[model samples]
Structure formats: C-alpha cells, structure tokens
Target: MKLLVCIKQVPDLESRFKANAEGVWYNEADLAFRMNEYDEYAVEQSVQLREKLGEGTELTVLSIGPDRVVEAIKKALAMGCDTAVHVQDAAASGKDPWQIASIIAAYAKDKSFDIIFTGMQSQDRGSAQVGVTVAELLGFACTTTIVGFEYDNGTITAKRELEGGIKGIVRMKSPALVTCQLGLNIPRYPTLPNIMKAKKKEIIAIPVADLLREESLAATTSFHPPAKKGGGIVLEGDMADLVDKVIAILKDKTAVLR
Candidate 1:
C-alpha cells in the first residue's frame, strides 16, 4: 500500500508573532513552527496502518512552504513515514486556499497513491478547503472528518464526524482521500533512535513553480492579530455594595430595567 499524507507547518501559538512590514502575513523569522495538530492525526493514521499492512506499505509526507517547514517534515519522518516531499515556494505564503490546493494537486496527480491523508483544517488558516479541493482536482473520492473506519479488499469504510456526537459513515474504493479529524489515533513522538534514522531517509524538495505555473488565483491584502481579550470585571465589596453592583450591571445590560 502506498499512502501520501499532506502536512502543514504552522506557527506555534505559544510564541510571540509579529506581522511583516506590509501587514500581509506574520514575520516568520523568529516564530517557532510545528506541524498542524490535525495533520499529526493524519500522519498517525498513515503510520498506524503500517502495523496492519506491514512491509509493503510506503508512507510519504508532503508539505508546501518555505525551507523552514522542513523541520516539521523531519518530525513526520521520525514518526514513521518512509520518506517526504517538500514543496518549497515563497509564493505559497500569499496564495489563497484554492491556489494552495492547485499546487498540491499538480504534484499529486502524477504520484499514483492509493490513499491520501490530510488534516481537516490548518491551524494558521482554518479554511478546511485543501483536502476536498485536491480530491476534486484529481478526481478522487474524498471524505472529511473521518473519526473511525476500516479498510478491506481495496475499499474503505469511514465514519465521518458530524455535529453533536453523531457520525456519518461513507464507503469508497481505493485511490481516495481522507481528511483526518481528532480521535482518529494518537500521534506518537519520534524516539531518539528514530530521529537519527530520519536524517538518513529520503527528502525530495520540489520547487513550487514546478507545481504552480500560473498567477495566484487570490492574494492576501491585509492581516492583523486578533484583539487581546479583556479582563473580566471583578466584584469586591460588602453585601450592600455587591447588591448595588449586581443591580447596576443588570440594569446596564437591560435598557428598560433602569
């Protein structure tokens, strides 16, 4: 079995972020980057299959970003993917969701993979568009939010996650794409030995231009950080003052209550 998992490197939210001078995107120079959380599930799903399918299964991770993203790719390698492909392109930063999908589809179209795994959405941009878009572009069966499933006889039966704890099941043959959601499987950290082995594994770098030749379908015009959260109002007083504060707050919230 040959599996391809699309991975994304996103900013570690715990670190500070600052926008570039143009305000189009974050200045990634000092920010720490990690694999998208959901993509980790996708990677784990691909790796877990190796236990069942065994020797013949080959898992490959693919990512589209600048060179810095390779750190995240190496982590996936250590996690158990047989190899990786890095699509390096500075233009990727400004491209919109469809443009990004187009780039991936261009390379994936020729790859002849039986199954492709991807995160339901990226952490930096929660568009949730790339997986399905790539499927459509490549004419593959696509299902998102797969929480559980099984594969047999070159067919896949997946349970899709729906709102309110409900799951929708879908079945499809091989050469399909699946967007992994949380709870699919726990992602394992790469041990020290595996980390060392990953350094020797194959990592093929492809220029983004080779995948995307046309002008970007869309572009980023402006971006800004979300506003800081406000501190909650604290009530500190004796009984009389507390009562007055509650009444005043309720009255302020309700115009007629005044």
Candidate 2:
C-alpha cells in the first residue's frame, strides 16, 4: 500500500494570542509552534497501518507551511513515516482552506497513492474543509471524524463519530481518504534512537507557488477578540418577585419588553 498522511504545524493552544496589526489574523510573533494535536492521531494511525502491512507498504507524510514546519515533518518521520514532502510557503498562514486543499490535491493528483490520512480539522483555523475538498478534487472516496479503523485485504472499515453520541460504520476500498479524529489511537513519542534516525530521512521540498492553481476563494476581512461580557445579575426572591424583577430589568435595559 502507498499511503500519504497530511500534517500541519500550528500555534500551541496555550500560547498567548493577539490579533495582528492588520486585524486579519493572530499575531504569530511570540507564539510557540508544534504539530497540530489532531494530526498526531492521523500520523499514529498511519504508522500503525504501515507496521501492520510491513515491508511492502510505503508511507509519506506531507505538510505545508514556512521553514519552521520542517520540525513537524521530522516528528512524523521519527514516528515511522518512510519519507516526507514539505510544501514551503512563507505566506502559508494567509491562505484559506480552499487554496490549501488545492495545493495538496495538485501534488497528490499523480502520486497514485492507495490511501490518504488527515486530521478532521486544523487547530488554528478549525475549518474542517481541506481533507474533503482534496478528496473532491482528486475524486477519492472520503470519510471524516473516524475514531476507529480496520484494514483487511484491499478494504477498510471505519467507525465514525456522529451527533448525539452515535457511531456510524463505513467501509471503503483502496484509493480512499480518511480524516482521523481523537480516540483513534494514542500517539507515541519518538524515542532517542528514532529521533536520530529521522535526521537521515528524506524530506523533499516543493515550493507552494508551483502547485497552487489559483487564489483563495475567501479572504479574511477582520479578526478580533470577542467582546467582554458584564457580570450576571442574581435575582433572589420568591417566584413572583423574581418574575417581576426580570421584567423590570428587561424594561430598563433592553428594547424587547419596552
């Protein structure tokens, strides 16, 4: 099997964030970057599949970002990916989901990969559109939010999370894509020996401009922190008195009652 797993580098959620001066995105100046949490599950699941399939299987990890994303690529390598591709773009942060997906689809279009793995959503944008868009562009069977996975022969069985705590089971053949969700598997940390070996792994760099088909369909106009809210007012009285107090407050403060 020839497998490709897409990964991303994102700001650590614990980082202190501020809007950029242009008010279009977060200020990345002081942020710490790491492999996206969701992508970790994708990487782990891919690695597990590769191990199960053994020698004949080949796994490649891919990422798009500035030079700093090489760190994330290396991490995936250490986790047992055979090779990696880095789609380098200094302006990657400014690209919307469609543009990002287009680049990935363009690159993977001719790779003849048997399966593709991606996180359900990116942590920074949480758009959750790229994987499905890539599938659409490539005409691959796609599944999302997959928490359980199994492979047999050329077929795959997946358990997907659904609304109201339900699980949907799906089965598909090769030449498919799956967006991994949390609870799929526990991600293993790279050992010292694996880390050393990852340094020797191949990381092929491709300029983003070469693969991009067009400009983003959407653009960010403005980004701002949510407005601060006032403290709540507690009404302490009998039911009738509480009702009267609520009406009075609404009359005084809002247009609804007035």
Best by TM-score: 2
Error of 2 at 145 (Å): 0.2
Q: 1-258 in candidate 2: lDDT tens per residue? A: 899999999999988778888889899898899999999999999999999999989999999999999999999999999999999999888999999999999999999999999999999899999999999999999999999999899899999999998999999988899999988999999999999999999999999989998788898998887786868787796999999999999999999998
Candidate 1's TM-score:
0.86
lDDT tens digits, residue span 1-258, model 1 = 888999999999787777888899888888888999999999998888765788888999999988888998999999999999999986577888888889888988887988999999998888999999999999999999999858887899999999999999999998999999989988999999999999999999998878885566666788887777878688886999999998998898878676
Give the TM-score of each candidate: 0.86, 0.89
Question: Stretches of candidate 2 above 4 Å error?
Answer: 232-258
lDDT of 2 at 100: 95
C-alpha lDDT values of all predictions: 0.89, 0.94
Q: What does each candidate score in C-alpha RMSD?
A: 4.8, 6.9
